[model samples]
Target: VEISQILLHQCQQEGDETADVGPGGDYRARNKLLEHLITGDETWLHLSTAETKPESVTWKRRSSPVTKKFKVQKSATK
Candidate 1:
């Protein structure tokens, strides 16, 4: 599928990058690349918790129904 092809392309690109700094290659470029490169593992985390339906209730007059605004909590990515 598309995912597999994308992963394959990434692997090939990684191989090419390594080859650039491998034996008989430009070691200086390797150092420069390493200095500027940033790497980290992909992680998903909940930065905030969303309120439940009951927790999202709003106080209003008996004869007047009021609208409740809900807060949306999104996940953090790296």
Candidate 2:
């Protein structure tokens, strides 16, 4: 299951700027894209170190509204 297509899809969905700066960084997005490419499903990829191979890459699934946490709530007590 090659995820290159999926990675590309996600990149398109996220737009170049957001995808580039998202969460961890460019490396994070690359790893995430790669995971989706390999698994054919959404997944996360963690880099063990700062070093990375030029060819290696990944991407993350477009976060959902719930996942993004658009709202804030105060604690309630009686």
Candidate 3:
């Protein structure tokens, strides 16, 4: 499934209380919850409790050239 779908599902599973942090609250809390979910940890996801508008959630996967080269070099070295 897509990351957004997984995230939204996770939020729903955790319940509305955790997903309903009002705007302007601590986004870092939400980010932390998302991080745990993405990283496959067992932490709870919490929504921000501020009065600001909710931020759009998005996800992207990035690969590192150094890691890619390292993998290739390790195979060559082997």
- Model 1 TM: 0.35
| Candidate 1 structure quality by residue, lDDT tens digits, 1-78 | 996687666665655354245567755333333445476888777677767899977778989966766667587765
Better of 1 and 2 by lDDT: 1
lDDT of 3 by residue, 1-78 (tens): 697888787776765343344678743234435546434446554443333444432344566333221222222211
Q: Pick the candidate with the highest TM-score.
A: 1
In the predicted model 1, the residue pairs found to clash are none
* Candidate 3 ranges beyond 4 A from true positions: 17-78
Pick by lDDT: which candidate is best? 1
Candidate 2 to truth, TM: 0.21
Q: How many clashes does the backbone of model 2 have?
A: 9
Ranking by TM-score: 1, 3, 2
What is the C-alpha lDDT profile of model 2 across 8-50, one tens digit per residue? 7776776534235556564333344444444345555543333
lDDT accuracy of residue 24 in candidate 1? 72
RMSD of 3: 24.0
Give one clash count per candidate, in the order shown: 0, 9, 5
lDDT values for all models: 0.62, 0.48, 0.48
TM-score of 3: 0.23
Looking at model 2, the pairs that clash are 3-37, 30-57, 30-58, 31-58, 32-58, 32-59, 33-58, 33-59, 34-58
